[model samples]
Target: MLKFFVVTGIGLALLNGWIIWWLWRALEHTGWLRPMLCLVVAVLGVSFPLLYKLGGDSAIEVWLLRAGSFWLGMLFYVFMLVLIMDIWGLASRLWAEPPVAPRWGGALLVMGLPLVIGCASWFNAANPIVREYDLTISTNDPVPQTYAQSPLILGVLADMHLGRIITAPRLVRAMDLLAPYKPDAVLYIGDIIDDHILVDVEGMAAALARVEPRLGHWVVPGNHEYISGSIKDSLDILRHSGMQVLRDQWRILDNAFVLVGRDDMSRHAFEGTPRKSLPEILADIPHAHRNLPIFVMDHQPSMLDEARTAGAVLELSGHTHFGQLWPFHWVVESMYENPMGLLIKNGLHSVVSPGVGTWGPPMRNTSRAEVLIVKVHFTQTAQ
Candidate 1:
C-alpha cells in the first residue's frame, strides 16, 4: 500500500507539472489570458480528481463531475496538438518570416480542431461497431468426434466500466448487436461497474437479466470489481441477477468444452483473497475433460504460459481496451503480445477484446468499441 501511494503521488506530481508547463506556453499573454490559463490548468489538472473524490453521489453532481473530467481530457489533447503547431511556427520564423494570419485565426484553429475531433470521437464511442472473429482451437490430442458435430458459438463482452458512461441504453445496443448471433453461452469478462462512480446496482442487474442464452450466462470478476473494496458486494448483486459468478472455478458446457474463469490479478491486492494457481485450478478438471478443449476466462493477458502448460486450448480476456484511444494503443501494444485480436501460440489460442465501454474519456479516438462474437471450432486450423 505504501508503494502504491508513493507511485500515485509521483504520477500526479508529474502530471500537474506538465499541465502547468503547457499552460505557460499556450497562453503567454498577460491580460485576461493569464487568469484563464490558470483556471484551465486548475480545473483540468487538479480540480477534477479532487472534486470527483469529494463530490456528492446525487445524479446531478455525478454528471457535473463526469462531464468536467471528459471535456478536460479532450481539451488536454487539443492543447498538446496546438502547442506543437505553435512551436513549429515559431521555429520556422527564426529562419524566414512566416505568412501572416488574423490573430483570432490561431485561436479558432486551436479550439476548433479539438471540438470537431472530440464530437466525432464521442459519436464513435456511443455507437460501437461489432467486431467478429471465427477461430478454430485445434489440438493433436485425442478429442471427441462429437465436438465436430456442431460449432460452439460464444458471445463475449468485456470491460463495460458501467456507471457514468455505460448506461442501460448503451448496454442495450451491445445486446442488440450480439443477439443476431444467437450464442449458446455468453461469457462476460469483468469491469462491469465503474469504481469511481456511484452505480445503481439494481438497475444494472435488471439490464443484464435481459441477456439470456440457452446454455448459461457466466461472469468473471475483473480488477474493477475489487475497486473500493466492493468485490464481495458486487458478486452478490450479480449472482442474484442469475449470473453464475465463477471465481477460480470451472464449469462444463454441453459436455464438449470446459470453461474456466480466473479471479482477477487484483484479488490479492484489493480483496485480500489469494488467487489459486493455474495448475491448482486445472487439477480439479477431470482428465477426460482436459482433452475435450479447455477455454479459460482470465480478465487480463497474464499467465498465458501457465494456462498453456495446463492444456488450456483457448483463453478469452480483456482489460487492454486496445489503448482505448489513439497513439496510446502503441503503448498497449508494447505491453501485450496480443493486445486486441486472436493469437495462437504453440496451440493455445487467446482472444482479447477491445472492450465494449469507455473508461475515462468516453471517447474512442482510434480504438473501436466492440464485442467479440467468436465461433469456436475444434478443427485442425483457423480455416
Candidate 2:
C-alpha cells in the first residue's frame, strides 16, 4: 500500500515532466513563454513530491496521495491540453486563424486543476457528509419471526474511508445526525476504514457503543477495510464498541425478518482470504426460517438473482457509493443494481443505500452521501 502511494506520486511527476517537455518543444518559436513554461515544470517537478510527503492524503498519508493525485490529474490535463492545442494550432495555421481560445484556456485550466483538487482536501476535512438516516423497517419473515404492523427503525451508515485525511469531526457529525432517527438498530454496510481513517479505534468504539438502538447494531466489511490493512483491528473495534460483525450468518428477528449477511465477495479476489460462501450460509439457515420472510444485509446488491433464489424478501446493501460525483453516476448505474433506493426483482426486494459517506474525492454530485432510512411495511401475498 505504501508502495502504491510512492509509485503513484512518482509516476505522475514523471508524466507531468514529459508533458511539459513536449509542450515546450512544440512552441520553441513562442520564445520566453516556452522556456518559462519549462521553468515552471522544473519547479513543479521538485515541489509536487515534497508536497506529497508533507500532506499526501488523509491524516495518515493523504497529503502525499492527494498531492500526487492532483499532480497526476494536472499532468494528464496538461498533456491532453497541449496535445489538443497542438492539433488546433496546426489546423489554424493551415486555414489562417489565430490559436483558438481552447489552447490558452486549456493551459490555464490545467494550471487551475491543482487548485480545484486542493479544495477536496478541506471539503472532506470539513463537510464529511454526515447526516441523519432514519428508517422504519417492518418485515414479515416467518423465519426470523419478524412480523409486525409497526415499522422497525433501521439506522444505516456506510463507507467512511477514514484514514489520513479524515478526522474526529467526521465521526462527530455522524453521531450527531444519526441520533435523530431513534433507530431501533443501526447498520454499517462496509468500507469503514481507509488511509486517513481515524486511528483512535478505541475512542471510536466507545462512541459507537453509546449509540443505543432498540434491537441491535450490525456491520459488514467493505473493499477498503482490507485495503487499509486493519480488517482484524477494525472488527475488533466494532465488537468492542458493541456492534455485531456478520460473516456469513443470519439473525432472525420476530420469527419473520432475517438479516442474512456474508463476507464481502471481493475479499478473496483482493486479499486472497477465502470468505464464507452464500451457500454455506443458506445451508445453515433453519429450514423453518427459509420459508419465512427474510431481510438480508449483504454488502453488494449484485447477487440479486442468487439472493432471490435463496428466498430473501428484502436485502439491504451498500457499496456503490452512488457514484459520489456527477458523470460517474451515469457509469456507476451500469454496475450496481438500483445504485440507490428500492429495487424489486421476482418478489425479492433490494434496497441499495447511497451510503453513509463517500470514498475518495469526498464530493457529491448526482447522489449525496447519506444514511438510508428505510420504512418497511410487511405485505403478505400468497407464499
Candidate 3:
C-alpha cells in the first residue's frame, strides 16, 4: 500500500516535469522568464522524492522529513496565495506598471533562503544526540542511601544505532560527560551497532573500554545483535571490552541485590519456550531470591504488567526513539501506555529513554538522542 503511493507520486511528478519543459518554451512570448524560473521549480518539484531518499541516511534527513511533511504543505498553500496576487498584478499592469524584476525576485529569495539554510545547518552539525537526564530515585523506598549522598549509580545507554555517521568522537564525548558522575556500573543497553557491530567492532570496543566505571560494565544483547553475522560476534565484542554478557540469567550480589538479564524480547526462543510468558520470567527468579531487590534488563520493555506484579524494582528499556520526527512523535507517544518517562506501578519502576542513537536516519528530528542518567533513590518520604 505504501509503495503504491510512493510510485504514483514520483511518476506524476516526472510527468509534470515534462509538461513544464514544454510550457517554458510556450511562455517565452508572454514576458515570462519561464525557462529560467518555472523550469527550476518544476525540476525541484519533480525530484523531491530523490532528495528525500538521499537525505534519509544523514542528519538533515530528520529535519527534511519534518519540513517535507508539515512545512511543505504550508508552502504549497502560500504559493497558491502568491499566485492569486500575481494574477491581480498582471491585471493591474494592463492599466499601470509596477517593478517586476526586483520586487518578486527579492521576495522569492527572502522566503526560500531560510529553508535551505536551516537544512544546511543541521547537515553540518557534528553530532545529532545531546544526552541529558536527571537521575533521582523515587523518594518512597528506604533503600539506605538517599539523595543526601552520592548514590552508587547504574546507567544504561542503549539502542545506539551507531552506524557510518555516529563515530568514536560522539561516543568519546559521551564517556567524558558521564565520567564526572563516577557510576558504579554502566551498561550498554543494546544495538551497539546498527546492522553489523563487526563493521566497526574494534573501534567501538576501544570506546567502550574507555568508559571507566568504578565497579563494572555490563551489556545485554539487542535484536540488532543478531543481524548480519552471528550473534556470538556481537557478544564477543561486548565481552572483550570488560563487560559481562548476561544472557537469560540472573546475577545475585550476596543476598541483597539481583540483576536479571533476559534475552531480547524479539528473539522469543534460544533453546525452548519454557512457558514463554511473563509469568515464566517471574518464575525464573529463584524462590529464595524473590525477596531481594531486583532490576531487569530487557530489550523492548514488553510484559510490563508481569514485571510490576512481580515487584520488580526498575526495568530499563530502549527501541522507541521517541518518534524521531514531528508527526511521528505523536504516533510513538500513543504506542506506549506510559510514554517516554518514569512509570512505577505496583512498586515497579520503568524508565524508557529516547535512546542515544538513531536507526532509520543518521540524524534526530524531534527528540535529540539522549544518554539517560537515572538516579533511583531509596528514600523514606517524598523530600
Off-target runs (Cα >4 Å) in candidate 2 are 1-87, 94-106, 113-149, 196-198, 270-274
Give the CA lDDT, 0 to 100, for residue 293 in model 2. Answer: 63
lDDT of 1 at 64: 62
Q: Give the range of the ten consecutive residues with the poorest summed lDDT in model 1.
A: 99-108
Deviation from native of the Cα of residue 209 in model 3, angstroms: 2.8
Write down the TM-score of every candidate: 0.85, 0.75, 0.64
Could you tell me which residue pairs clash in candidate 3?
Answer: 135-375, 136-375, 137-375, 137-376, 137-377
The sequence of per-residue lDDT tens digits that candidate 2 reaches over residues 63-168 is 5454443443245445655676667768988888865544444555656664575455335434534343233333333312242456566777777665554444
Would you list the C-alpha lDDT of every candidate in the order shown? Answer: 0.74, 0.64, 0.59
C-alpha-based local distance difference test score of model 1: 0.74
lDDT of 2 at 167: 46
Pitting candidate 2 against candidate 3, the one with the higher TM-score is 2
Native-to-model Cα distance after best TM-score fit, residue 34 in candidate 2, in Å: 9.8
TM-score of model number 3: 0.64
After superposition on all C-alphas, the RMSD of every candidate to the true structure, in Å, is: 3.9, 5.2, 7.9
Better of 1 and 2 by TM-score: 1
Residue 164, candidate 2: Cα error in Å is 1.2
Model 3 lDDT-worst window of ten = 69-78
Ranking by TM-score: 1, 2, 3
